[model samples]
Structure formats: C-alpha cells, structure tokens
Target: MPHDIISGDRHPEALPLAEKVREEERARIARDLHDELGAHLTGIKMALGLLRESLARAQGPEQPLEQARYAEQLIDEAGDAMHGIIDDLCPPIVEFGLAEALQWQSRMFTRQTGIVCRQRCGDGLDELGEFEVITLFRIVREALSNVAKYAHAENALITVERQGDVLTLRIEDDGRGFDLASAARNGSGLGNMRRRAQALQGTLQLDTVQGKGTTITVVAPVAR
Candidate 1:
C-alpha cells in the first residue's frame, strides 16, 4: 500500500501549477473548437442555406442532384464536427478508467490508422488524486497524438504502473524517432505534455532513437 496526500497538504506550488495546466489546456481546446468544429459548422450552415434556396426555387421534392450531394456533404461535415468536439473534450476520461480509456483509444486508433497498439496498466492508479489523474492523462494523450501525427510507426505500446512511491506512465512507439535534444524546436505537442507533467511536479522522460522508436515516460510522486 502507498500513502496518500490530500489537497491541503500537497506541495504548495502544485495548486498554482495545476491551475496553469487547466488554463492552458482549456485555451487549447477552445482554439481547436473555434478552428476545426467551428469551420465544419460554418460549412454545414452554408450548405443548408443553398439547400433552402434551391427548395424556394421549386426544385421538386426529390431535390436536385447537387443539393442532395451537398446535403450528404453537410452530414459528413456535421459528423466530423461532432467528433472533433468530442475529442477536444477528451472522450477517454469518461468512457473508462484512465488506463482502460487509453487502451480503448489505442484499439480504435489501430483500426483507423493501421498501427498496432498495445497497452498494459497495473493496479492502484484508479485511486490516484484527481489532479494527478488529470495531469497524467493529458501528458499521455498529447504524446499519443504526436505519435499518430508524426511518428511513422507500425506499432506502439503504452504501459502504466506504480513503482514504490512513484506512479509511471509510458508511451512507446516503434517508429522513426527523432532527436530528443531537438524537441525544443519541434511542435507544441511534446511541450504541452511537459507542461502538463510539470504542473503536477512530475518528471517527463522523452527517449528517442532515430530509425528505432520513441518512448515518453512520466513519473509523479504517488505519495504526494
């Protein structure tokens, strides 16, 4: 068994850092909503307007081929918007425990992207404090998103377990990994994960070997 730290006794800095993380992620979510879903909805609205206009012109009950085609397009757009918004909300946080959520996502990702995803999580994580859980989830989520986008991987693995007083989460991929030292010049994905981990006074280790694979590990004090 491990000791537990409650809110009032946690490291004083953790609260401020957690607040920063909440703000940062929330801002990122808002921006994504405005750019992705907002764009899709706008397109859908325009398509509906065209449909209405075509109807006003007595285009018949069957409607014109172009309008039907556009209607289908609008439906697709709406689906995409809904998916984006749901993703922004972090669907995994709700459907399953954090570990199980990641596994489910990995399976879905593999089916959609043709990459093998493996997951293993140990016990005790389910009882972690709320902030610890949130921060850890964000870090892993950001790492995997990067993998899906950048890593040319055929397979990936995510493992979570507790070691002594520390809880660790890792995301590893057999892909064309890049230089860890150069991450400072890369996209904001890794940076976001680092920030999220730091907010919890946690440590993030990003290990990558070009032509091999990349591994990102996060560890935070379970006792804290």
Candidate 2:
C-alpha cells in the first residue's frame, strides 16, 4: 500500500493546486465573455443605430419611429449591462497597473458622488506582482464603495506606500463613523475586507469614532 494513501494528513500541495486550477478556469471564462458577448453587443448596437437612421431618412410613420427609438434605447441599455458584466468578470485594474488604476477609480468616484477623493503613491511599487496589486486595488475599491454608501463623506483619501519589507494601503474618509462591533455583527462587508487582507498574509486595521470618521489600513509583505 502506498504511504500517500490512508494518511491522516492531506497532501500539503493539494489546496494550492486546486486554487491554481480554479484561477485558470476563471480567466478562461472571463476572456470568452469579453470577446464573444462584447462583440455581439457591439453588433446589436450598430444594427439598431443603422435601423434608426434609415427609418428617420424614410420619414416613417409615427408608430414605427417611436418603436425604432424604443428599440435603440433597449440596445443601448443592453450594451451598458454587458460592459458592467465584463467589468465584474475581469476589470482592467491589473492591466492598467496599480497607480493608474487607483487614479482612475478615484476620479470616477469623485465624478459620481461629488466626493473629493484623492490618491497618493510612493516609490518602488513596480516590483509588486499583479496579484498583490489587484488585491490591494480591490480592497481600496471596497472601502470606497462602503464610504459612498454609508459614510455620507465629503472628502476621502487613499495612500499607498512601501515601507521596508512591507507595503501599506490606507483609506480615510471624513464621514459619520459606525460602531465596529455593531457593523461586524450586522453586516459582512467589513468581515469580507478582513478576509481579503488575510488572504494576502496581511493585517487590516479599522479606526473610527462616532461623528468623527473612518480609516482602514492594510499592511502586507511585498511579493518580490
């Protein structure tokens, strides 16, 4: 009988191998959805646009004109939905690099809610791997999403820097602070943030005082 079988302890490498397989499958699916569905949505939008133009030039009846306009609107909506799906599947965060991604995200946040969001970065971050960069970006994004939804904040700041052998990500918002215990017991957002931080072998700290503001800081080892 093989010693590998019937052992109380499982193989040390099994879990990592499984995760690797899962990640590969996810990438494949994301690529297919981006290429196939994106092209299909583009074609539908173009066809609808041409039809609308043709109907306008032909001086069609009022009913057909209204129907054509409605169809075009639906097509536009579908296109927007497809883009949202693609973004969720595989965001361009990693592709654009961390600093650029952070800048873009902050700009969008500022534009959407009129909240002044600022970002700053330090040196030597280029050596960080894609996984580290994307994970940190996502952590910051989730923090901002929470701020916008619950913080009612007027100003926010995101700072990223490398210190010695560790990298730090900090997000601060000047909004109404919540009781950490209450939020943890009531919702899973904070819990999920902590889990993501732990996944990177990092530590997450939250600081908030009622009527003051909230700040989230995460520190992780740099993947060299």
Candidate 3:
C-alpha cells in the first residue's frame, strides 16, 4: 500500500518558484494600475479640464470655479500616487540598467526624504540578469527606507561593485545606529532584505554602531 507522509525537508526548487510567482504577481498588479486605474484617472482629469473651461466661459460664481480647481488638484494628486505605486512594484529595468536604476533611486530618495543620498556603481553591472537586478534594487530600497525612517541619517551612500564572480552591494548611512539583536527581533524590514539576498543565493551582513553609523552589505554570486 502506498502512503503519504510529511517530511521536515524543504524542496530545493521552492525558493526560486516562490520568487517567480511573486514577480509575476507584482508585474500583473503594476500593469493593472498602469492600464485600468491610470485610464480612469486620466478620464477624470480630462473631464475636469472641460468643466473648468465651461465654468470660465459661463463666468459663473467664483465659488464654483474654485471648487472645480480644487477637484482637479485632488485628481492630479491621486494620479501621482498611483504612478508611484506602479513604479515601486515594477521598476523600469528595461529603460534603465541596474546602475542607472540605482542612481535614479538615490536621487528620488533624497528628493522625497530630504536626506542626502548618493550611489557609486562599478562597471559590468549592466550585464546582470533581470532577476539579479530587481533583487538588488529591492534590497537597496528597503535599506534606504530603514535609513529614512529610523536612522536619522544626514547622509547615505549606496555602492555596488563586482569582485570576481561575486557582486557586493552596500548601503551605508551616517546616523544613529540601533542594536542589531533588538532590530532582528523587532524589525520585519531586515528580515525581508535578508530573504531577498537569500533568494539570490547570497549573504547579507549588517554592521552598526550606536551613535555612529550603519552599513548593510549583500554579497551574491553573479549569475553566469
């Protein structure tokens, strides 16, 4: 008789399969946001534009004009928010390579959070696969997010370099560092970054000193 039994072992293919599934899901959501919600928002904006024009022609009450302008502003803000969400889910890797993407992310981080952020990337990173590029991008994003939220950092740097067949990515911040043990126990962001590195068959290290700074290093084998 054949019987099924539970095992304490994990399948070797599980990690890659799960990663693929997640990527596909993110892509789908991004596409939907870009296509469906984006279209609806655009339509609303156009309609508002027409309403404003009509009100201007009629020379109606000033209050109505003000209300229309306010509604238009709200629609614009929503459109911007939607685009930001889409970009986060699926970055424009096709348009910009890994290095360019990292640089753009640094600029955007500084602009949004008022923190000085910079990036230095070594050559040969343009040849990395999409999976590696996206994974590294995500790791950097999460690290920067932590820096912004908790680090009280005045400056942050993202550096990427390749040595032999291994790629090393570092996010360093001059800020008040936290206890690694306590963060590990309380922070899901750190765990998420580690998992992303593990998905690439890499290792993640965190170095932090209280009242000094913090550095997160991810070393992963470059996919040949």
**Which has the greatest TM-score?**
3
| lDDT of candidate 1 over 1-224, digit per residue (tens) | 11111112135466546656665576578667767867877777677777667776775775565666677676777767666775665453533567767777778778888888888989877777656665676676677777888889999898989877788888999999876556556566776676666666676777777888888878878762
How are the candidates ranked when ordered by TM-score, highest leading? 3, 2, 1
| Alpha-carbon lDDT of model 3 | 0.84
The clash numbers for all candidates, in the given order, read 0, 0, 0
The TM-score of predicted model 3 comes to 0.84
Q: Which 10-residue window of candidate 1 scores lowest in summed lDDT? A: 1-10
The local lDDT score (0 to 100) that residue 146 gets in candidate 3 is 92
Give candidates' CA RMSD values in order. Answer: 7.8, 8.2, 7.2
Candidate number that wins on TM-score, 2 or 3: 3
Best by lDDT: 3
lDDT of 2 by residue, 70-102 (tens): 987887788788677667656776677788889
- Model 2: weakest 10-residue lDDT segment is 1-10
Query: For candidate 1, what is the TM-score?
Result: 0.68
Q: In model 2, state the lDDT of residue 193.
A: 66
Model 1 lDDT, full chain set: 0.71
For residues 1-224, what per-residue lDDT tens digits would candidate 3 score against the true structure? 11112121144335555776797799899999999999999999999999999999999799888899999999999999998899888987534778998988999899999999999999779778887888899989999999999999999999999977899999999999887656666767887777777778777788888888888888989965
Q: Residue 33 error for model 1, in Å? A: 8.8
